[model samples]
Target: MSDFFEALPGAVGSPPQHYGNPLGEQKILVDGSAVVDLGHRGIVTVSGSDRLTWLDSLTSQSIAGLQPGDSGETLQLDINGRLEYAIRVVDDGDTAWLLVDADEAAGLLAWLSKMRFMLRVELADRSADFATIGSLGTPAIEAAAPNGVPLVWHDPWSSVVRGGHQYAQVAEHPGAEWSYSETLVAPSALAAASALPVAGTLALDALRIAAWRPRLATEADEKTIPHELDWLRSAVHLTKGCYRGQETVAKVHNLGHPPRRLVMLHIDGSDGVLPAPGDPVAVHDASDIADAAIGTVTSSALHYELGPIALAVIKRGTEHDAELAILSDGIRIAAAQEVIVPRDAGAEANVPRLPRLGAVRR
Candidate 1:
C-alpha cells in the first residue's frame, strides 16, 4: 500500500478496491481540495535517449512529440490486435513515467524489458519507490507532483486527440469538462496528504462512470477492442505510422463494426444495493433474470449526485433504445442506456449496398 493510503484514517485495506469515506470524500474531491491515495495503481519508468521514438513506434498513441511534463496515454496490443495493456504516461525529458493498474504492472514491465532488444531504453518498476495521488481538481494533486521527476498525467477523456477519432456524436460529451489528474508523489509527499480526508475507488468511479470514461483495469476483457469503448478519443492515434495490431485497428475503424459498444446505465438504486463488476446485464425484454445476459457490468457506483450509475459493454447488436436490467442481490435493477459509443459506430455506417451479414462466407 502507498504511504498516503496508510495515513488515511479509515483505509481498511487494498487490492480489488480501497476503503474509506467514499460519498463524503467525493465532495472533498470535487469541492477543490481532497487527495486520494491510489492504492491499486502501479508506476513504471522508461529511461534512455531512444525512449520517445521507441515508444512512439510501439504503442497506439503518438508519443514522438512528448515533452517534459506533458501527459498522455497509450495502449499495447497483441499481434492479433487484442488489448494487452493500457498506460497513462508523462515524460520528464530523461524518463517516461507510466501509471497503470497494480495487477498489470509486472506484465507491462516484463514486456517492455523483453522488447528493449536494440533500443537504448531501460525499464524499471517504480511502484515501491513512488506512489500516486489522485484528485479531480488541481488543488491537492498539484502540490504533490514529484519535484525532481515531477510528472502529472492529466486525463484526456474530455477531447479528441490528434489523429484520433471520436465515436460519441453528442454535441457536448459529459467528459468535455472532466478535470482529473494523477500526480506522482514520493514518501514525503504522501505524508503531506495525510491531513486530507481519504476516499476509495467508489468516489472516483462515480465521476468516471458519469463521464463515460473507460478504464483499462475495469473495462478490459480478452476480446476487448479500443474502438468498442471509443478509446480512440484519447488513447489511439489512428493515422500514426505502423505498430503492432495497427492493421486491425485501421480495418475496424474504416470498414468494420465493433462487436460490442460501451454504454452508461442509470441504475434504479431504490433497494440501496449497488451491482458489482461482472454482474449480468440483460435486455429487459421479459423481466426474467434467467434469460441470457446481453452484457456485463464493467464498473458500478452509487454516485453522490446521480444516485447509481454503471458502465457496461454490451453486444453492438443490442438496440440502442432497448431497456436494460442488471440482476444483482436477487433483484433486477432497471437501467436506461446513455450511449457512449453509438450503436451504428464505424466507417461501415456510411457504406451502402452491402450484401447481407454472411453473404460473402456463403
Candidate 2:
C-alpha cells in the first residue's frame, strides 16, 4: 500500500482491502454513487511524436491511429505469445498515459526504456504525481483534466472492437454492463474525494468477477495465451500489422486451439468458505483416479448477486457440462461450470486438414 492508501479513513489490511462494507459498497458502486481508491495502481507517461506508431509496432492492440481522448487496452506479450503486461492506455495528444498494477509499472517502464533506441519517446513513472480513482461513471473523474482532457480511461471490455474476436458462446456477456473506468487525479483531488462514498478493491474485484473480466494480474500464468481468456475481444487485433507475438496469435486463432480455456464456476457455498486462487478444480465424479484435477481456480469472490463465484482455467478438452469440484483448504466444494472460452474456440479459418502422403485419399 502507498501512503495515499494508508491515509484513507476506515481502510483495512496492509493495502486496505475495504472499509468493512464490501458487499454494501458493491451495491452502491454499480449505480455510480461510490468511488474506489485505486492508489495501488501505477501510471507511466510516454511523450514524443513517435509514441503512437512506436506503440503500434509493439503490443497487441491497434492504436497507431488513436486520437486524443481515445482509450484502449493492449497486451504486451513475450516473443512466444505469453502475456507479460496488460496495459490500459489513454492518449491526451501531448502524452500517452499507461496505467497498470503497481508491481508491473517499474518493469513496464524499464522495458519501454530499453526499446526506445532511436525513438523520440521519453518515459517517466508519474505515480508520485497522481493517484488512481475508480468509478462507474464520469462524474467523479471528468474534472481531473490536467491538460484540458480528462484522464479517465473508459474500459473497452463492454463489447468487441473491430478486428477482435469473441470466444464466449453466450446470448449476453456479463461484461456488457461493466462500465468501469480508472481516472488519474492529483493529490489534492484525491484528498477531496474522501467526501464521496468509498469502496475497496474487494468490492471492485467482486463486481469484476461477476462480469467475467479477465485480469492479467490474477488470471495469467507462463503458459497462458490471449485466446484462452478471450482477451482478443479487447486487447488483440487480428487484422493488425505485425507485432510481437502476432504470429502465434494468428496461428492459434486460425490453425489450432488454445491448450486451455477459461470458465466461470458457480460454487456451492454451504461450507461457508470461498475457494482461493490456485485451488485445484477437479471432476466431481471420477473413474479410476482418486481425485482427478482438471483445472485451477484463478480468482474467486462472493458476488453481490451471484453468491460465490470463481474464474478458473481448465483443459480445452474438459467437458463444458462437467460437474466440477474445487479443493480449497482440504474441503471439497461442488461447483457448476459456466463456459467462458468454448472447447471449439480456435481454428477460426476452418481450413480442412490434408491427408498424409503415405495414406490413400478417402
User: Top model by lDDT, which number?
Assistant: 2
Per-residue alpha-carbon lDDT of model 2 for 92-174, expressed as tens digits?
98899999988899999999999999999999998878878888765454345767787879999999988899999899999
- Against the hidden reference, what TM-scores do the models get? 0.92, 0.96
Residue 194 alpha-carbon offset, candidate 2, angstroms:
1.5
| lDDT (C-alpha) at residue 216 in model 2 | 87
Give the per-residue lDDT of model 1 (tens digit) for 219-262. 98999999999999999998889999999899899888899999
In angstroms, the error of model 2 at 337 is 0.7
Estimate the TM-score for candidate 1: 0.92
Q: After superposition, how far is residue 16 of candidate 2 from its true place, in Å?
A: 2.7
How many residue pairs clash in each candidate at the backbone level?
0, 0
Off by over 4 Å in 1: 1-4, 15-20, 141-149, 348-362
